[model samples]
Target chain A: MKSRLRVLRAERGWSQADLAERIGVSRQAVNALETDKHDPSLGLAFRIAAVFDRAVEEIFDNPHRTEGPG
Target chain B: MNPFTTGPASREYQLATAGWFTLYGVILFTVAWAVDGRGLAAPWVYPAAVAPALPIAGFLWTVLRFMDRSDEYVRAVLGKTYVIAVHLTLLLCVAWGFLEVYAGFRHLALFWVFPVFWVAVAVTGRFIRTTR
Candidate 1:
């Protein structure tokens, strides 16, 4: 799943490691999310959204979306 | 804190596992020493052989506890690694069994199973990281 994690993290001026620590995961995991190499679970998506103060949908684009708003 | 392999909880997990394995090795060697030159017909032989399983069970429990305490992503990484290791170990062991039976290869000791699995995990993990 593609994500705007790097953009949001950049807006916050937080490095990958800083964002990772806030979300309680390794920087590699955060990198995986940012690079679309790994899809976050629902819980992790929520945690990421919580860290960024945004909705989960705002951070992760649902790869399955067909009729929904992009 | 490096959650993958090093943290307070991770340290606890390693130390506990190490301690249990030490006990397991000690029990196995002591039993072997006691039974040396003695026939397996003795009543105590079977029980002595089975005694090492106690520490092994403890070791497994310690692993479960480590998984229980790890963060979600770390647990996921470990879970996938273990699954890969399990399948790889089974595949290789089965292939080796066929060769041992049909091609006259030497049989491996049963005690090498866990070590073989760990080796597979390390190889698979490295492959994943390097490919990434």
Candidate 2:
């Protein structure tokens, strides 16, 4: 899944480690999520959203949702 | 330091693994001394032979506990690595079995399977991407 995690983290002046600490995961996990190498689980996505004070959809682009009819 | 190894869960897993492996070595040595040096009799030797396996089970339990306590990405990466390691170990052992039967290869001890699986895990983990 595509994510704006890098952008979001950058805007907040947070390093990968900073964001990872906030989300209770390793920095590598933050990098993986930012690079689209791994998709976060629902719980992790919620946690990330909570950390950023945004909606999950705001961070992650839902490909399935985009494929549906308007 | 690897981020995966920095957490409390990792520390606990490491300690548990060390404890279990140490126990395994001690039990194995004691059993060997009893059976070979002291001429331990039959029936009793059976349980003695099986004693070392308990610590191996404990070692596996530590891995499970570590995975349960890890974050989602670490758990996912480790889960995949273990699956790959299991398949690799199975393939190697099966091929060796066939070779021993048909090609005059020497028989390998079954206890080697545990170490072989860990070797496979190390190799697969080296090549597998844990991060981007």
Candidate 3:
């Protein structure tokens, strides 16, 4: 899964630790999420969305999903 | 709290852990000395022998507090790691049990359980964190 967590966090001018603290997670976790080394669980995706005031789908995308022709 | 866990531990938790272990160690030494030198003649000897368990309880409390202080992502990572650790530990223990029963091997000590579980968790966590 690819995420816009870095973009959203950068827009807020918050460092990884700041975002981690806000989200109640370690900074290492935030780093892992931004680098796509780890994927977030549903509950974590919701938490991240809540932090950014965005829908979960807006933040994370499943690259494996295919789009059908309109 | 007692130098365990990958996540950070609070100062109070660390202090309590250290203090408890120090006390536990002292009590353990005292018990061993009394048993060896003077024998378990006194009524208090039995209670003194088990005093080391108090620190184990304190260590467990610190572990709980450390987990509570960690963020959700860290907790999730650790929770998954714990599951892996449990599975590995269980398999090792079961295999060892079978070996003892079928092959006439010496019985293993119960105290090796936590060490095996934690070691598995540490190794698995490293791999999980590094790999996609």
Question: What is candidate 1's CA lDDT for residue A67?
Answer: 67
Ranking by DockQ: 2, 3, 1
Residues B67-123 of candidate 2: C-alpha lDDT, one tens digit per residue: 888887778877888899999999999999999999999999998898898789878
| Best candidate (score: TM-score) | 2
Candidate 1: residue B88 lDDT (0-100): 98
**RMSD for each model, in Å, please?**
3.2, 2.5, 4.7
TM-score per candidate: 0.82, 0.89, 0.68
| Fraction of native contacts, model 1 | 0.11
Worst 10 contiguous positions by lDDT, candidate 2 chain B: B1-10
B59 Cα displacement, candidate 2 (Å):
1.5
Q: What is the per-candidate TM-score for chain B?
A: 0.83, 0.90, 0.64
TM-score-better candidate, 1 vs 2: 2
**What TM-score does structure 3 among the candidates reach?**
0.68
lDDT of 3 by residue, B5-105 (tens): 43454455557766876876787687788889778766877686667566677767765776687655555665666678889999999999999999998
Question: Residue by residue across A1-70, what tens digits does model 2's lDDT show?
Answer: 8999999999999998899889998876788788787899999999989988988888899887846333
Instruction: Tell me the lDDT of model 1 at B120.
Output: 96
The chain A TM-scores for the candidates, taken one by one, are 0.91, 0.91, 0.87
Which CAPRI category fits model 3?
acceptable
